[model samples]
Target: MITMKEIARRANVSSATVSRVLNNSGYVSDDVRKRIMKIIEETGYIPSEHAKALRTKQSNVIGVILPKLSTETSSRLVNGISEELAKHGYQILLANTNLDPEKEIENLKLLKSKQVDGIILLATNRGQELVSEIQKLSIPFVATGQVIEGVPSVINNNFQAAKDITSHLIEKGHQKIAFIGVDEADWEVGHRRKEGYLAALKENQLRIVDEWIQKGIFSIESGYTSMKKILESGNERPTAVVCVTDRLAIGAMEYLGEIGLSIPNDIALTGMGASDLSKYVVPRLTTIDLLSETTGAEAAKTLLEIIKEGNTSDKKVIDYRLIIRDSI
Candidate 1:
């Protein structure tokens, strides 16, 4: 029978390194990790969970709380998290909130009741109530997409990315640009994104029409309504429009079509979030790639570190890119 010690011997690493690779406790370079894993697979060696359970008292399950399961963003996040967690022999207990903030709190406690080793929240709104509930958790925890005070998180650069994309429209001679965003409850997506757009205009010394800035929920229909509002705002029509999300942008596009407005000809449009639909749309969307998968992977890795080593970074920022496509 293949033993861990023998596996270590074959892999030319200490048993502790093999243990780290199996236990997901310590850092092992990807090269060494792959080599050890390959040997384990060839030898058909399975570590005894009974011993691991006794030593660590861990359930080997991670609880993931998501705002909504149906969205492309949520799906990509889950794929990244699951891929990373699976490397360490951990499974996910998914908790879908369906975009309700209150459900986030409820799922936190529910995951705790399930005796999950750790919890990760794909946060939507960082309300005080939700933050307070998270603070009460004794187990390892991580948040993605939104930062909570003193909590470890992996988030996209909403502010800078938003500003840069807005600046792109400006560089294309779009001084009369409009913005469609969400409510301020979602601090990062709502407030930070809006602030970034506003900052870009300020830097370029441009004036914004009062009616150009509109707010809506995270929905396609809401986006349609918001864009309708922007166009009918006044005699001064914006040459371009920026929507906070791809879903919103798609909705806006539908509205533009209904009114027989040609994209980038009648009015240029931009959106954040590089969703799948963005690529295949009538006019490919010019949007920001938020690296949703990376966000999930980073949060999962951090949560594992917290659970195993009791040490982790308080915050990690994910990267994003502005994708210029046919729409803009």
Candidate 2:
């Protein structure tokens, strides 16, 4: 637990000067700044958040509120945020909201009290209330995944991506395709993906069966249970299933395997995000590549622009690709 005082002693600068260098405050020569940074690094000095908040009146910390850190998507997004923010000399204060709005709101309030410079929200659903609160506080923030009105966000075209995936399945001769996803009326991703699924079906003139469409929480367990229920209902299983995410695809495939079913031969599965694991699955998953890294890079760049320029910009929409692999 090396303190700033130790770093100051090692750098032969006053504690105040060390504090200034750490907070990017008053003029410190570039050479001196470099030396101080080196000393801080060598000393493993942990700066006081309270002191930082007081001197800079900004934490120089970015709040990263994610749905679930365990998921591949959230982890990749966090990695991207880390990579991009590191370049700007900012650190992240991560919070797992567990897809709970109450938790998300609580985390936002805590971050505000801590005086974080800005927040990069990987929020789910409509964040209108949270965004409104941020606006009232005059705090800088940006969202990822789902966008709300008046909030700048970084996300892929979910509707288009889903539409493309569904169309791909249709082109693959999957007329009786099933869509398994989150609840459409609530979750933004669920709604957008469902829109895409419907679009493809309507465009191809394929019948959309109510039984073939299922929605649940975004989890492997939820996917497994929903799929199992779908199977037990004795309704003829479709030739293919379009999962809203790779996690769901993985879970559905696992259950399908256990029931003595084989992929592509019995059923085909398509995932939304082209997660790394998707490539290594028994039958490589055909999916939409969300370009999560590129999205993260762009989000970080946007926030920096807001911080430096003191202005909010339009939402950034990253492009996605339909990746055709063995699963289709």
lDDT of candidate 1 vs native? 0.91
Q: Write the per-residue lDDT of candidate 1 for residues 1-328, one digit (tens) a residue.
A: 7788999999999999998898888799999999999999999999886666656688788999998889899999999999999999899999999988889999999999888899999998888898899989899999998988889989999999999999999998888989999998888999999999999999999997779999999999988999999989777788889899999998999999999999999899999999988999889999999999989999999998998799868899998988999987
The TM-score between candidate 1 and the true structure equals 0.85
**How much lDDT does each candidate structure score?**
0.91, 0.84
> Which stretches of model 1 miss by more than 4 angstroms?
1-55
The CA lDDT at 312 in model 2 is 84
How many collisions per candidate?
Answer: 0, 0
> Candidate 2 at 309: error in angstroms?
0.5
Residue 97, candidate 1: how far off, in angstroms?
A: 0.7
